[model samples]
Target: MKPRSTGTANGCEWTSGTSPLLTIRGLCKSYGTNRVLDGVSLTVRPGRIVGLIGENGAGKSTLVKCILGLVPHDGGTIDRRATVAAIHQELSLAGGLSVTANLFLGRERRTRLGTLDHRTMQREAAAIFARLGVEIDPRAEVESLSVAQMQWVAIARALSAEARLLILDEPTALLNRDESTKLFTVLRALRGRGHAMLFISHKLDEVAALCDELIVLRDGVVVSSGTERLEPEEMARRMVGRELEALYPPRAVPQAGTVLRLEGAFGGSFELHVGEILGVAGLAGQGQADLGETLAGFRPLRSGGLTVQGRPVRFRSPRMARAAGIGYLAADRLRDGIWRDFTVAEHVGLGDLPRYTRRGHVQHAAIRSATERFIDTFQIRCRGPAALVGELSGGNQQKVSMAKVLGAEPQVVVFNEPTQGVDVGARQEIYSFIARLAARGVAVLLVSSDMQELIGLCRRVLVMRAGRIAGCVEEDPITEESLIYLATGVHGT
Candidate 1:
């Protein structure tokens, strides 16, 4: 049977008369008592993009895992007729490996003498990057690259495999608008070439813009699936089973008191007032990472003095930053933020161990009680506080990260990409949570690549270019155009 065609992808017309590349029937998976996927079924056809969307803990990851054979399903059948590859939500590249080595990791080229062929691999790696229209050095180590560049590397690696069926999970979460547009162009090109893709993202607008079909999953079941195009609002409603509120909460007024101050640090100086959310924005790799790291105490400030609540202090570590009433929400939830092996209770209580501790001996009951409270307050979906953090979904993990930061009662917070991989419903919740923080007089420094996030939540945004403060925009209603022009140095109407 021919695949059903629906919406246009970018400018590419939907492909018709194509056979199914992959199919599943009655797919079910269970982790002990938790039913992650229940009777899920879907079809991916060649020359089309299928958008898989859902809320956190909605079995999207489990379905992907079962399809990739990373996990075994309880009862199901997944039929695959084409070569498959998956771009993970979390980066899966070897950090210590070079770009060239990572691209040719398992599928290595060797000379007739059975030795590794370095020249051919490097040449092919460069060619792949060129094909993707990204400028990346093949010799550079993956760990040395910035997060956006690393995401490009991951995409290039996936394309290098030349798989016909590609599964991408939250692929554009770390990418800025320009970068995302470029990537979408590339995906459109791939679709034109008859490659099938299962695109999983929490960004509803992206799903609407790029997919030929929409599949909505909630609570481990497919609630909506069709060939017709679904609007963002309809998709959000289906994913959460209710009418969704605005993605961003109403802004609060900032109090007139400087809560945190940095002078000449990382090529800029700024003061954060009480109850104010100051945004840091720019094209990727424009010193925003360094600024966030410095504020969070991961890196030392260079050529500047840091002050908190009128007290000059230097923080060489996170502990020192926390002691000085500062908290940080890292962009990379897997690496710098949450501990996968730690229990929810342990991770939440980690921010303020003293509250749950009594004279050096840890208080387990107190920790569990506090974590349970957070789970309820934040609406985190999991079995209990004792559940491993790794078992939680991406959005829930992010919620836990926010809980950990806010639970410490810090006067200032550095939130980097606070809603990177969260779904629409959870995004609203998080926006409200941050707004409440601002209402309570907490100073927030929001470092984000998502422009809407900066526009929606920040009172003043500092746009960076080439590791310096390029411009600052403080419009009553910030426009994406102003931020883009400042970020790219493009002077135009």
Candidate 2:
């Protein structure tokens, strides 16, 4: 192949052909009898991003896991000797460690005396965040950050490694619009510097805008591959087809009842009608959590009280909230929804084991049956009920969390960023479940940072600003524009 010049960056030209930074041919992975990947082939050249697009459980995450050496692909020729690194959807950073520490934990800079060079790591960490167009404190602990903020730390850690072949799997799943934009800017800059990247995301728009080439995968095989970047809509159509696979399950038939009611509360008062998907939306830390936490009993309600099914109640803790027939699906699934070492079956029976108990003993049979039911109902992909929750992909993990929540059969469900790290397909499953719950007269409170999520899935939206409800947008005027104006106070209500 000829060494043709595309464009020169920093005095070096990125050319195509014989020397791909990473190449995979006839890759295959199967779990027991089910094949997850089959004969997948692709090449990622330096200074280019090869987007891997697919619906949830369509082998995208499995493919990256195979590349990262985290999972064993059954068969394939992966001719790669480069320093390969990946930042997966589920973050594995140390919560107690500082950003600089997490960034350079295994490969810390040391002086001749062999002591860690803290100042150097801090400076470099700060520089990496700045380059990514995000402002995060290098000294801040990972546990003290939001989901979006934590995602930046993960990106910083991957970039700081300076790997030759970097793989990012849904890195923006938790990020807001601004954070995602910043991340894209940094990815483009890295591409200019001759870095090779495999970008896996459900956000096809990002794939369309950032990737130099795209590969669409479906049902364990390659469906389409394009050398040139494709438009967002076209890429989306290729991935899932023109007609959506019932993105949001048809709204459950409406019912007249009151599931949760808050009086004179922070972020203003709002009553959750039974079967209503009430959206509490705003930018990060703009009181979305203030309302969600209060309702979930993670934060104390100071002024007014809560009423469940027309009965006045006050919750002292999350335990109390759960006892009151409330299901709280936190925004950060890893931190709040999961026990890292627990199994799928164990997580399924987490909050309410009594239901599975028989004759003063925990009935393993009952738990097994329930696990099977939840797996089938939630469409969770796993190696059976014994599979460790941590071993599942982020999307699968989100499904597990959903199963855990809905398994309790609560009268009301509160989801704070319900689809944060989930893929487009899994998102539909989750949305369908929420709607189904509402159709059954179970109220839902959806607190999301994604404007589109709120507009599309919610019937009533209350925008919060500075810890108060700025305004309300009902079904009639519930466009993204109105939500933005209400959240930012940019336009007259």
Candidate 3:
């Protein structure tokens, strides 16, 4: 069947002069009883950056998937005049392969004999790297590259495809301010070259600055679409279906009680204090991941002392850290968070099995009850506990990851970009959850490149520069300007 187009009267059109380069109309999709996309419609004109904003489960990803022919939409029409390229939230690069190999894997330049062209691919890969304003060794393995570098490589590969329409989903999540600015510069250059882009991001300020038009989705439907002239607050209200009084909740004054502390912490070179949510911010290469890994026991600290409740603690491994009442949630959920092949029940129950299992055997009934409780509590959209984690949406997958950590009941919860690709509503929910965790006296340490996320969720923000604590600011002093000043090493109040 021909897919139905979603660019009907219900759709938002930025231009009235001519037809768009790509048009979507009546896009409807569902998984059993769960209707993900309900007649969602949109349009993207040539040489325009179209911003797609929505709450979690608002059908943004589903719409993109349908356009990419990954998920078969129940009813939709996607009309396109040119080839489409997408940079998904999940890194699509093969981890085992080298950077150059992944970039030209399927679309490699070949000889008449149909063999792989190695020299040509490497040379072209280096040029692509140069174009992106970064110097990455083409021969280096993908596994060795940092998350931000890997993300750049993915974008370079997409650009190399010479696509007319490029879709970037949360492309700046892992990048620091400098790196992100460079990326924006590249994107603007692309826009100048008449490349139509569908930019999906949770950063409202970025959407306002970059996009020529805005399309907002809510509950799997197109609620608002217009020229990029609306106020950020207005745009957020439309996406979330409510007015937000304050983006960040009021920070509670830290009491004198001991929570968690690090004495002369020498992971690389930094010291962490109790009752502080240190905001580790830098240009992804500046040792943020290294610090997080060290804190989580994934990497060894050269010579450091970690303490909780005024007692010296030793965490040699992640298991040891968990045993010490410290929980670490990795930024890459697909790799370290959830077991994708496992069922939802299995995923949620994996961390809390000891609590449910009394004797040597496991308690299936107890596990089911616990999973159901988490699903209801978190408002997780899924078929059932029996459904595989891989089958769920990105938002739902993140919820599963959170459920696993929350089930463990740790004293200190270190969240590494908890809401990287999550939509607006899910972000709000996650923030609320984090606040509750703090209210319950669980020391929350968040490492996020997102300024708004750090400002909103954290009480006291410590800016990390070049693998050390540059400066610290309380909530009263926490503003975008101040955070950027510390992050970029500028002087400000």
Candidate 4:
């Protein structure tokens, strides 16, 4: 079987070998009462890239885990003849380690004298980065590199071994368009080398561009697959079982009231009105993090004041910000958003403990009840309110984080990379939820590097460039080209 030509992937062609490289049949998995994977089947042939996509709770991650033997499946047959490597979605490389050390941390090459061959490792690391078209100092600490650079290192690590199969989970979620294009070029090169890969991402366009074959799961079952090709929108519709009436809900008109104003802000001094999604758009490290953190009280302003309803307020901490009706959702849902060891009920209850407490004693019943409501409202997939928050998928964790913020009943909500690692189907729902929040008169401050997101969701966007405001884009004038131009300051004064 051969895939139809796709321009997004630079017209790469692949042929399925006479025999399959990997075959999965009748896979089954269950967690107590919830059946995550049921009767799922697929074949991954050599010299081809396969795309796997679905909603957050759609069992995409579960399938990957089962195939990788990372988890035990209930009933399944996985036949594999090729060595496999998986690139994680999180920080798989240690920050304290150097790039050279990280790439060969476990599988270090050694001389016959039983000594670690540091020289060979360094030379090989450089060669790998060169092949991937990325520049990284072998001795440079992993902590110092940018996200794109780290991703390149991860890719190098995966290819470092002579594995024929590579699995990438959300490879470009944090990267910008230019970075994504470079990554795609590397992927095309890998395909040219007759490497088999599985590309899993929430970005449907990316899947369409890179995959020679596609599989989409929904509610623990495969709903669509193609030896031919499927459009991103069509795949999206099948995944969610509904037409995308609007990928982004309609934006509401902002009132004549400025709910929150940042005076002399670090990234960009901007005013957010009630019922508006004020976007902060820029490339990574252009002070967008500063803007979001400074607003959320995670960082202190050097020479700025935040005014709420004309009253100047100084928040020294996140508690102070929340007390002043400012709710924040950090980009990293695991690190800053929720407690991994905590239960779903505990995570949500921490948002507004007062509502779940009577007297000084904690109300366990109230907490459980509130968590149940939240789980149902957000459609979070878990065993129950007592399930560990970290055990849930990335999308569910994100929903829990959003639920915590909404429970705070804040007048101002700040979301950093609102849908960073979320799948396409879940992304639409989250977008609608955020839109509804804005419609309900919540002043939302959205800071992200995704130009499409900023253009699709924000009515007005403030483009940041090198810690300063480059331009303010209104609804009519906001485009990917315009946002990138303004963000990079490549076209106007």
**Per-model TM-score versus the true fold:** 0.90, 0.86, 0.86, 0.92
lDDT of 4 by residue, 392-477 (tens): 88888999999888887999999999899987766877888888888889989889877788888887998888988887888584
lDDT of 2 by residue, 1-493 (tens): 0122234553223344436877789999998888889999998888888899887667887887777777888898776645567877678899999988999988899988999999989999989987777899999998998877788787778778656678888888767687778778878887787778898888777777788889998888988997866876566666665455656665554478777888877746778887888888887678887788878778888887789888898888987888888889888888888887999999887758878887888877778889999889888888899999887767789888888887888888889888876667677778888888888888888999887777777878889988888878986647888888877778754
Q: Give the TM-score of candidate 3.
A: 0.86
Cα lDDT listed for each candidate: 0.86, 0.80, 0.77, 0.84
**Lowest lDDT block of 10, candidate 2:** 1-10
lDDT of 3 by residue, 1-493 (tens): 1123344442322233344768889989998888888988888877799999887667888888888888888997877755678887678889999988888877888877988888899999999888767889999999998877898888778767656678999888767677778888888887876778999987787899999999999889889887948777788899889886566665544445766666565323333344445566654555666667776778776666767667777767888777777788888898889898999899767876787777778888888988999899888988788989988767788989998988888877788888887766677777777776676667777888777777666667766777776666675657888877866787774
lDDT comparison, 3 vs 4, better candidate: 4
Candidate 1, poorest ten consecutive residues by summed lDDT: 1-10
CA lDDT, candidate 2, residue 206? 78
- Candidate 4 weakest lDDT stretch, 10 residues: 1-10
Model 1: what TM-score? 0.90
Deviation from native of the Cα of residue 213 in model 3, angstroms: 1.8
lDDT of 1 by residue, 1-493 (tens): 1112233543223334576778899999999988889999999988889999999889998998888888999998987666678887678899999999998888899999999999999999999888767899999999999767888787777777766788888888877777789889888988887888999999999999999998999999999998888788999999999987777888768999999988876666888999998999998889887888887789887788999999999888989999899999998888988999998988978878888788888998888888999999899988899889998988889998988888889999999888888888888998898899999999888899888889998879999898888878999899888998888899766
RMSD values, in order shown: 5.2, 4.8, 5.1, 5.5
